[model samples]
Target: MGIIGINRSPSCGVDITSKNDQEVAGEGVFIEILRKKLEKNISIDMVGIKVLEIEKALIDIQRLINTK
Candidate 1:
């Protein structure tokens, strides 16, 4: 799981294990790239599952946003 998380981080950029040390930028860009890569690697069935997980995470973010 740790390895997967690291691989999914924007820090990975276009490389498998490379890290992006951007001094400036929002997290959205990083997440978007990682998600695109993940979708490209997995099957359609798995994509659905990953989408659901993303939806849940978005919901959680909404909650946090509301709290702010």
Candidate 2:
């Protein structure tokens, strides 16, 4: 598996690995912009072990989307 580092926060660094390397990937600002643009269409799936605060952030994002 190839590991790619993502700058999330000082507390929790992010990484993405692939069984096969051909899959496309991006992180941080790229992800944020992609997510914002994707809001009207679908959800993106992320697999990882997250810290408590990061999980909370995810929950907050879900809430914002759900409330909208």
Candidate 3:
């Protein structure tokens, strides 16, 4: 399975985060830590999305589900 998180969150962001009052590209601290732990076992997908961007998020969710 994959993880879905807030795109602009500082703690739960996956692909985007709020750093120094600016949005930047990177996993949040929590997600980064989790990824490191999980990577030791098996690789999995992580995605970030904005609540207002439901359509795009849905596509990402579909892609994650379709990952083999």
TM-score, per-candidate, Cα-based? 0.25, 0.29, 0.91
lDDT of each: 0.37, 0.41, 0.91
Regions of candidate 2 where Cα sits further than 4 Å from its true position: 1-27, 48-68
At residue 14, candidate 2 shows an lDDT of 35
The residue pairs found clashing in candidate 2 are none
Superposed on all Cα atoms, model 2 deviates from the true structure by an RMSD in Å of: 11.1
lDDT of 2 by residue, 1-68 (tens): 11222334322223322324332233444444555676678765433333455775566456545653
Model 3 lDDT tens row, 12-56 = 999899999899999889998999999999998988889999999
Error of 1 at 51 (Å): 8.2
Query: Where is model 3 more than 4 Å wrong at Cα?
Result: none
- Clash totals, every prediction: 1, 0, 0
Q: Which ten residues in a row have the lowest lDDT in candidate 3?
A: 59-68
Q: Largest lDDT belongs to which candidate?
A: 3
Per-residue lDDT of 1-68 in model 1, one digit per residue for the tens?
A: 11122223344322223235533322334544656676787522111112236775455445544553
Give the per-residue Cα lDDT of candidate 2 at 21.
Answer: 35
Clashing pairs in 1: 11-20
